[model samples]
Target: MSPRTEQQYEEIREEKKKLIMDTALQLFANEGYHNTSIDQIARTAGISKGLIYNYFTSKEQLLQSLIFSGFDEFAQFFDPNRDGVIEKEELHYLLREMFKLLKEKMSVWKLYFGIMLQPQVMKMVEKEVYQYALPYLKLLVDYFKKEGKENPYLEARFLSAVGDGIGMHYITDPDNFPLEECVEKLIALYQ
Candidate 1:
């Protein structure tokens, strides 16, 4: 074959990076981050350990990328810039979509929940998460403000805490969790 064009090279690079990311995410989700090593990730990905290093400097960086990637996907789903004011139906749609994503990505959510409970891991990821999360939180605050709720900021915080608590419950007891009903009740109570 003639030398590959720049586009072909980029395509190959992206494919390899995605393979590495998917393999690492599955491993991290199934096994705790501290338990999973670069060698394990590389072996699981069917790549050499050194190749993994070429993509990610360390396992911690790999984990951060996985977390950030999930958030990026979430941002795409929500698309925070597309509206004038948030309506109750719109909020409900958002919550339902979120629940769908959570169920679909249960393993990743489990890995995320586990990491957040560990102080050291939390320290490493807290800033990045807050940065990613701020826009969504602000969206909620804006919704409440538009609804004429007093202390919209505090209400937004309360709603966020409730959502987190509900998520933890769902993550721990997914089979038995009445997610739709719970979400409906939350909407009923808040809206």
Candidate 2:
């Protein structure tokens, strides 16, 4: 095979990996992460379980991949370079964007919610800050610091709790949940 053929093959492999991730997240969200097995993911993706092993060594690794991919996508949207003096509109946009993504990305976020309660995933999350949601908390803290706000870590933690509340409601009823109204109420809490 030519070099171009090899590159095409690699691209196909990456695409397959992404499909597997999407299927895994969907199943995990709908079925609950604890109930989702590697075999189930493989079946949902229409691939053999053995083929999944070619992409991910284990189910945990697959879950981690979904988490990291989401992190990377949103990091840019939040503007890490901002001075942290977010205006009300920025806050609204943030709230809206978060709710929207969290809705569309329900499976991934659902897996994340469960992962936090799992001992092994929690440890892995702390140890690999670059690869998980810990960076978001850290980013919030640092942003607050740049703005001369007090106790950024505490503020970040508090916001995380608030987010969880809002997220839980949405995840529980994605079909008819009034996320926009909920977000308005959520932002009003800060007012």
Candidate 3:
């Protein structure tokens, strides 16, 4: 076989990193983050424990990475145009896409809410979470204001809480959560 090029090596690295993260996310979601050990993740991924360290400095870092990856995925649906404004159509689009993502990546969202419910685990990444969310929060507030909501900030927060509740409930009972109906209602409310 020809010697692997730098690009090939990079691809291998990314694949392995994703494998580790995927394994960790599953274990964390099903087994609970604190109960899962690095050894378990390594065994599950079929990689040596040391290999995980090469990709992530620690298990905590791995958890943070998983959380951040989910955040990044969700961010794409929020402001696709990068125009710093969300039109009514854009708001509906965001709601539809967000629910689609939740359905498609159920395990990832389960892990996210699971982590958020655990105080100790959340503390490890709370600052970063707020940093990541602040801009989006501002955007929501701006959108609500533009929509002529009397209390835009409160409206934004209420919407956020509603999203969180929907995610929590859907993950808890995905088989009968009426997810599509809920998304439709949310879109209507925002409109």
Best lDDT goes to which candidate?
Answer: 3
Candidate 3 local lDDT, residue 187: 78
Point out where model 1 deviates above 4 Å: none
- TM-score of each model, in listed order: 0.91, 0.80, 0.91
Tens digits of per-residue lDDT for model 1 on 1-191?
A: 65999899899889999999998888887787888888898899898999988788878888888888888887888887777468888988888788889889887788788888989988999998898778888898999999898899998899888988888899889889998899888878765
Give one digit per residue, the lDDT tens place, for model 3 in 107-149. Answer: 8899988988889988998998898788878988999899898
How does residue 59 of candidate 1 score in lDDT? Answer: 80
Error of 1 at 151 (Å): 1.8
Candidate 2, 1-191: lDDT as tens digits? 47578779999998999899889878876786669888888878898999988998888788777777766776777755557456545656777798888877777677777766778777766565444456567666765666577887887788878888889878777788888888888878655
Candidate 3 lDDT for residue 138? 90
For lDDT, candidate 1 versus 3, the one ahead is 3
Native-to-model Cα distance after best TM-score fit, residue 55 in candidate 1, in Å? 0.8
Error of 3 at 64 (Å): 1.0
